[model samples]
Target: MVWKIYMHMTSMLCLGVAAFFFGGLSLVSMSTGKCSLIEWELSSLNSLTVVFVLIFDWISMLFLSFVLLISSSVLYYSGSYMKGDKNFNRFMYLVLLFVFSMGMVILSPNLISILLGWDGLGLVSYALVIFYQNEKSANAGMLTVLSNRVGDVAILLSIGLMMSLGSWNFIFYLQDMVDEKWLLVKFLVMVSAMTKSAQIPFSAWLPAAMAAPTPVSALVHSSTLVTAGVYLMIRFSSALEGSKIQSMLLIISCLTMFMAGLGANFEYDLKKIIALSTLSQLGVMLSILSLGYPDLSFMHLLSHALFKALLFMCAGVVIHSVKGYQDIRYMGCLVEFMPLTVAYMTLSNLSLCGFPFLAGFYSKDTILEVAFMSMINFMSLILYIMATGLTVMYTMRLIFYSLSGNCNLTTLSNIADEDKIMSDSMSLLGLGAVFMGSVLSWLLFPECYMICMSMFMKNMVLMISFLGALIGYMLNMLSVSSKLSSLLYYKEVVMFGSMWFMPFLSTKNISEAYLVWGATNEVLNDKGWFEHLGSQGLYYTFSKIFMILSSLQMNSIKVFMKTFVVMLVVILLFFS
Candidate 1:
């Protein structure tokens, strides 16, 4: 009990600190006439509009507030959940580091600052994921780090390119770059974003990330790291506009959404299901953002962070109560066993599925509406239809399989209600899932639709999407398998087969040597005899040239060092 009080106080103090920093940022941003709290002066404005720094700064603050809220709640829950565990101190320290790094990621002014925070968050996440130090957890952490590093390379390259061609200052370069240069930069940025957001081919890591504890998964997936990509998209939307890359983004996002939705349906693991669903939802937001609805994307990201965090926490409660078992197949009749948890989970999932008056309804509908408005061709329309259908399919599956399915009373009978701290955390996040939209709509956009048709269209789409979800629920009740089953089955086969083949097929072997030899022979055959010999001679010449250049460079370095030493001796003698 004393430990619980101490943890609660510590979390509260962290929140207080975050609030102070955010408030200071707000004040500075308001004073600076910058659109975001962190300001850089630019000579040219191009198509980008300049607003008071309060706008972007407020967005950063909002994200920071979410970090504080969810991290604090997790810390509070951990007080009881991790009680007397040997690694409890280590866990708390990593958790605090995770929160701090995420806060920095959000509040960071320039790309350098953001990268610093981003890498810090990734490191902390890796540490937390492997906190248990089991083989599976360590492997998962390693894979997560490896995959994120691929994305980091692209980001680093983009930063270098931006610094070389544009200004090293983010806002200045962003505003000054012409469309062509901006397009190139945006392409690199998109690659980084897609990898970080867990879109399409890069998405496999997020489900693997579920090997972490539930609170860590919640923090990584919803509130902080995963959302970084969407934040980047919104932040750089102006540069992305009118680029061909937007079409590619739309296509990739639609495909990722559909694939993730299909994967979620086949997932029996509760956390994996939610993790895949989070990926799908993020894909939808990315698609919407690509369609030129930054505001809607921001709103959806915020709503998802709230509800998904709540759902994950509630899922944590269920897992904790059941002694760490997470398979939905083994979990049933939970409504009666843990009523508060069920209630919170139900509310959050409902919100996730876009039930009326819930947070998800407002954001999801906006995405669908934006898709409809922006889709200009038959191909795009088909993609949008597929994406929407997939969303309904997976969201309904998550709701039905986890919460509304037939009960397994025997297994559930052994479980008990969660402790008070855990319950409090769930209740707080769940209430936000239930009511954040209405409150934020008033506070952030009172005139809302009247001020922006785009915003209005987004909200209308969200409403219709909610109605679509209800229809999907009814369709699910009718006991008909959605036509997507075959596709999902095929995907499963491909995924399993690919995993089996990757480690073996990619290994260098006689077959690879034969293939390489055959390809080389074919190229040689295509060339005339003289040409082939000439090519070999050219390669030899280049090898010799490289050796000569390397030797010259080494000689120069040696000469320079000797000269420097001599000069240093003479200077020392003169001083003496």
Candidate 2:
């Protein structure tokens, strides 16, 4: 009880801090023309320097506030979610560690310091992922940590390279790279960001990380861990301007958006659906950032964070009520029993679908409009359209499967919103998901978006959204067993649903080959030839030599005595 109260106090304290920053910093931002905060020197040397930085521009301040706000709510929710665990204090400590890591990442502009935060996040996330200590959690935790380690290495390398620039702080070079060859630093930073955001090849771990606790998922997956990458890219957007990497990022991010949307359509797990949705939104953030629109990307990031966090919290409520059955097929007709949860889910899901006047609408529509305005290739444009449609498609499919059907679970009949703590947390985030988009847009962009585009282009997204909804609903309700059998039984649909065989590639395939090689090496080298030839062979060889010497020594003593007598006699004769 004392620990829970302490958790509450700590969370409230964080919220209060965020509130002060949010209130006071807004005025500071308005009054001061410059967004850069006062820098505190951590260390200084001729060629290596480090500084503690707090970028108080709207982006950093607002993002940190949102992070702390969500964190506070997550901490509050965890009090109820983790009520009676044996390692409850340990859990809280891990959470605080995760938050501290995120805070460090948010405030520091130094590449080395950011790496400090970056590695901390990966480490704490691994601990949190494996907190349950089950087989699934263990496997997921390994994947999460190992995959994130790639990013850690990337940032570490970048920090080493930045030493050439005489400072570890990246803020000094945000306006431009030091020189042309320093593009390597930009590329390295981008790679680091991609790993954190779970883009393309790095995406397998995000969904797998769903094995973590609900609060971890709600906080890490939604607001902090994934957004770190997007925020990094946003910070480095100027250095990336006109570099070929942005074009590549554009293509990769678009495909990631499409892949996640397609995967979500086939997924039935409730938390996974939200997780994949988070991935899709991450792609959107990256795609916009790649177009050199960091401010717009920041807007989308903030909006996506609110809705996605609420979506996960709502998912947590459902999962908790349903007694850990996460399959959507077992979660039918929950709307009637759990109206508040359903409402929260609906609002967030609608926001995800770009429902007008909702939080997702403002940023999402802006991104699409900006994409349309940019002189992008036909392929990227097509991908953007289809990815948007897929977002709606999967969301509609999720709603139909989980919320609209008859009661499918046999264990519990009367489900309702009785958990005050969980509901209260969701309520706060729900309010954010509803209003955050407009608020962030107004605060970030004083001038409204003014883009010139054709009517077909303008209406195209809405039409695609409608078609996606139609397809999603039909796909869920349609009785096509033969079709599904062909799709599900075949390797192809399974592959698509398994995120194009990513988990297989990252886990079993990689582990199996290494395990086989390890076994072979152990048996053939360590045990067989090398073992015999090394220690045993040498010992046996020395023993045989020693045995022969012993035999010679024993036999030669008699001969030696006889020779000695002969020599003595000859010596006597010679003397006479």
Candidate 3:
């Protein structure tokens, strides 16, 4: 308990530090309207040199502030959520370390030093994901770490490729190296970002990482861990412009958004739904980054973090009150049990769908509008619009099943919002979800982006939301629409309904195969072939050589005496 309070206080102090930076950056943006970076040369003793830089630009400050804010709230929430765990102190330590890593990723302009923080995050997050000590958590932790390891390795390769420049500080060299000659380096960096951000094939791990505690999901998944990739791409935007990889990333990111949104619709697990919601939002951020609007991407990144964190906290509350049944199908009319939580959930989901005047409304709406205005190919345009619509589809599905439907819960005796620790943390995040977007838009953009497009393009998000609401409503009346499930294409539904077979790929295909290979090598090589060929072979060969040497040594005394006597007799005869 002392540790919990200490962590809460520490996190609050972090929030204060972030608040100070936020104010200073906003004031500086107003005055100078330029980036001010403080770079201290860390190593100049050798041929290799690197700078430790903390960029105090609006983007850095704003993003860092949001990360810290979410960190603070998550630590506070963990005090309640993890109070019963035996290793709660270790949990607090890991969470603080995770936050510190996120801070490193946020403040560093040099990719070399940023890799330190990046790798730290992956290691600590793996520990956190597997903290539950269950088989599911174990698999999830392995997937989470392995997926992120790809990025870590990619960064290392990028650093190696960057050695020609004599420094790994990308901010200093990337602008000059934007030509075709540095394409491999740029591609490595982009691939690293994709792995970190959970794009496409690398995306299977994000939802699986929900095996972590809710606080980890709220802090890491919704904001810090997943956003690191997008944040990196945002900084590397100058070098990445007009690259062929950007086009590929655009397609991959759109697929992630569409697939995650569709998976959320088919999902019944409450935490996983929110987890998939986060994946979709990540795709949105990645999409905008690929479109080369880091400002808007950063904007949506901040706002999405605010509400998505709140959404997870709300899910945590519901799960806690209802005694750990995560399936939304088993949950209904939670509003009757916890009104405050339901309200938070509603606002966050609406914000997720880009509902008017909320945090998600500003950045998400602008992203869609910008995409529509761009001369993208037909498939890209359709996917963008449908992904936006699917946001509403999943949000409504979650709302209808979990919040407003019948009170399907069997045991309702213990359900209540009595935990002040959780309530306090969630209430703060809910406030941010409600107001952060407008404030960020006004501060960051100052001037809104004006685009001329058709009404279909402008209203596409809303139209989809409207239609999704009707479908979601009808579906919630389960008896009336039971046949709709049958009417759906079973094979297609099962394919996407299983999250594009991601669970199978991550848990069964990929991870299980590695486990099998590891076991095979251990049995065949370590205990079998290598034992005989390496350790046992050497033992037997050396033993035989020693035995022969010992026999010769024992005989040497007799043989030498006989030889000496014979030589003496022969010498006497010769002398005579």
Candidate 4:
């Protein structure tokens, strides 16, 4: 046990050091407005060359630094969270592999190199998701992997399509290939990004992936796997600007934001609620990216990562204290027992809601303001407001249910914020959640955005947030004896609460339909046409012919004797 703790400390120290190194480099690159690309020629044949490209732009460097930082913290937290588990070492190894894969994705600019990292992430995520080795984990792993496989295939197709250009370095060629001739490659890249980021039809897997351990949840949802898609999209934003695909992306991201926010509000599972919030924030990043603001999206991505990871850590602490129970309905007035954790949770949750000057506010508020200033359609603008409100609503509901309400757990429940290792890990992120927004705002935006909106339009963001908070708190403030109001709108609750039946659509419905189709296929082909035209038919036909020959041989003895006699007589006549 001592050795395991040492291992965790050693890994944390190494990663923390590396994070600082890259962070300084990122700052240098950003300030100098310079980037470095190193290429190693792996092979060259027939005018096609495979190059392993490492890009050291401020974007890659900054993202890499954040990923390493979060990874180091998660490892330290896991040392406490996964204590006494027999497979603790194995879990640590998987996490390291996951971090390595994310680093590959961050540093590679070549499509082929990126695919290698992309696929590594998918494979490692599957391994980590099913780490518990249970039926639910198994199922969730399957859904997660299969959902990501769609994106994997998209990346593979993009690689194939890029072959015509003789080089896989898309960054150098995206602008030149912006015509319809290369539109499909850009579209495929976007689709792959969507799946990784869990947008729309692909959103089911993100919630299902909550079957993973909480440490993995924090890492996956925050800096590593899911954000890979947004990062990839940011890299490709130049090609996507002003295209019809961007418009479509805008619509899909808005729907995803609204859907995830609504679903989070209705969610009971604490982990699932946070997972859906991640989905909603991913939509925020992608939507801004689609609006031709990749830098803003990238800024939101970074700020969101800090608070989201911190939020998941708090969730982990709570789940650990409650002996693995996750239903928020069974948790109340936790602040009484775990004040420090609740404090961190509140900070992260407020940041998630874009509360003033918090980490989320700097990026998220800027996105809203810039989006409002942009010339978008009526529907998009309405969804922007609605999704924003829903974000605050769900956050408030979570806070009220888990922090201020009457106690729901047993009177003797032992819950406290005494885990030093876990607390230390969360401390750094808590600081980030409080201050990373303003820091990133200053760094990412050299010149501030000029706002000329009317007082009403300017205050609309505050108004919606306040309204959402009021509704969320008021709706959940019910006595134990009171009838549930949600029961009155059963259908609406069911629809919205279940992510509009996305899990059903992605898993159960699709599996059932395929099973029925397989049965029909068996009856029509494997057991029907192939039965008559394939091996069975040939066997029966050949058997019948052999039976006829056997009967002829058995029944034709007289004819055989007559033929022999005739031949003998003819021979005798010829001799004479």
What TM-score does each of the candidates earn? 0.76, 0.87, 0.88, 0.90
lDDT by residue (229-335, candidate 3, tens digit) is: 99998888988788887888889999999999888887788988888888888888888788888888988998999898998988898888777888887788878
Rank candidates by lDDT, best first: 4, 2, 3, 1
Residue pairs with colliding backbones in model 2 are none
* Tens-place lDDT digits, model 4, residues 1-576: 997899789889999999999999999999999999999999999999999999999999999999999999999999999997899999999999999999999999999899889999999999999999999999999999999999999999999999998999989987976677788998899899999999998999999999999999999999889999999999888888668889999999999999999999899999999999999999999999999999999999999999999999999999888878899878889998999999999999999998999999988888998899898889999999999999999998898878778788866568999899999999999999998889888898889888777788788999999999998888778524478878899999999999999998999989889899999999999999999999999999999999977765885887678778989999999999
Q: In candidate 1, what are the lDDT values of residues 1-576, reduced to their tens digit?
A: 576568656875677577567656645664564654544453445534322222256677766776677777777777777786777777777888878777766765466566777788678878877887789888778767766777777778877776654344455555555368567678877887887797766776677778787777877888787888888777777777778888889888877776776666556688987887798789888888888878788888888898998888888878777667787756665776678788888888778767779998777755565566654566766666665665666666656655666564444346666377788767778878988877666545545553334665555545545655776567555533446454557756566423322323323353478679888877767465546567876888899999977765886878778778999999999999
Candidate 2 per-residue lDDT over residues 1-576, each given as its tens digit = 886768766875777577567756855776676576667787777755587666666667767878888888888888888887878888888987898898788877778778888999999999999999999999999999988988999898888887777877677777658356777888888888888999998899999999999889999977799999998888788888888789889998998998899899888888888899899889999998998899899888888888888888888888888888899988888888899999999999999999998999999999999999998889899999999999999888888878886568767544789989888878888998899888878877888778999999899889999999998788777733225554546677787798898888988888899899999999999898988899988889999999977865786877778878999999999999
Clashes of each: 9, 0, 0, 0
Ranking by TM-score: 4, 3, 2, 1
What would you estimate as the lDDT of candidate 2? 0.85
lDDT of 1: 0.71
Off by over 4 Å in 3: 34-46, 478-490, 511-576
* Worst 10-residue lDDT window, candidate 3: 479-488
C-alpha lDDT (0 to 100) for residue 347 of candidate 3: 93
- Superposed Cα deviation of residue 189, candidate 3 (Å): 1.2
Q: Candidate 1, after superposition: displacement of residue 73 in Å?
A: 1.4
Better of 2 and 4 by lDDT: 4
